[model samples]
Target: MNTGRDEDALRWDGDDDPTLDVGTRTAGADPTPDASGHDAASGEDAPPLALPDGFTAVGKDSDTVGHIEADGTVVMPGDKAPLSSPMLITLGILAGVYLLFTIGWIVGGLRLQGTAQFLVSPVGYQVALWLAVAAPALWFVTAYALTRSSKSWVRIVWLLAGLVVLVPWPFIMVGAVGTVAR
Candidate 1:
C-alpha cells in the first residue's frame, strides 16, 4: 500500500527528528513492501505493536531538530549556542573600552578648544567629534553581527582593528601634560 510518504522521509539529518519513531514492527507485516503472502492487496489486519516498559511515545510537542533544506543549507538545532560566556565577556570588555573612548573625547575636546580654532564652526566640530568617538562601537557591533556564520577569528580580527584604528587622537595628544600652547 502507498502510505503517501516518500522514501526521502527515511533520511534523518540528526537526532530529534519527528519521523524517527522508536517502536517495534507489527507482527505479520514486513517493513518493506513485497510480494509475500501478506501483500497490501490482501487487506489483512496487522496486530498492534507491544511497546516496552517505560517507553514514552513521541508526540506533536517534540521539537523539530536539524535538517538540510531543499537549498542545501544545513539548519542547526534551535537550542544551539549563539555565543558562549567567554565570548560575551570579550564583547563586554570591548564595550567598556568604547565607553572609555567616549569619556576621553569629552575631556580632550575641552582641552583642545583652547589650543586651536577648528576649520568648521565649534558646533559642527562637536557633531563630527562625537560621531568619530561613537564609530568604534558601531563598527564592532556591525562586524560581530555580519560574521555570525563566519569563524570566530574573523570577528576577533575586525574588532581588534577597530580598537586600534578608532583611538581618539585628541585624547592621545593631550596626555598627562594636558593641551599644549600654540
Candidate 2:
C-alpha cells in the first residue's frame, strides 16, 4: 500500500514545534490595549505610531514617511529618486558640449603642431597638446564628483563654469573649423 511519495519526508522534524508558529499567541500572553484602546496586533485606526530611532518624518501632516531599517538608518524619498527629465536632458547636453570641446582641442592642437615645434621641443609640445586635449574631460569628471552631494543647480553651475574656462581657443581662432586659414 506504500506509494513512492513519503509525506513525512516533505517536512522537517521541527515542523510540529509550537515556537515555529508565528501567528498564534503564546499560552499566557494577553493582548493589551495601549492609549486610545487599540490593541497593538489589531492595527485598526491606530494612533500615529512612534518612528524607530533615526527615522525622520517628512511632508506636510506627515502623510508619507521614509523607510526605517532595523539598524535605525532611514531611507529618504530623495535619497533614491532618479534624475528628473529636464535634469537628464541638461546633463546630456552638457556631456555633448564636453565631447565637442575635446574634439576641438584635438583638431586645434594637431593643426598647430608644426608651429608649436619651433617654440617648444616636439616632446614638450606633444605633452602639452595631450594635456590640453584631456582638460575638458578632466574638468567634467572632477566637477561631477565634487558636486555629487550638492543640489542640481550647483552641479550645473560648476559644469557651466568649466565650459567657459576650458574652451578650445586655438580651435576657434586657427583650426580648419576657424574662419582664419593657415
Q: What lDDT score belongs to each candidate, Candidate 1 first?
A: 0.65, 0.80
Question: TM-scores, in order shown?
Answer: 0.52, 0.61
lDDT of 2: 0.80
Error of 1 at 42 (Å): 28
Top model by TM-score, which number? 2
Error of 2 at 18 (Å): 17
**Residue 139, candidate 1: how far off, in angstroms?**
1.7
Please identify model 2 stretches exceeding 4 Å from their true place. Answer: 1-78, 177-182
- Score residue 83 of candidate 1 by CA lDDT: 72
Candidate 1 residues lying further than 4 Å off, grouped into runs, are 1-80, 175-182
Top lDDT prediction, candidate number: 2
lDDT of 1 by residue, 14-95 (tens): 7567677555566775554232224343355433222334434366523333444454454434534457678889878887
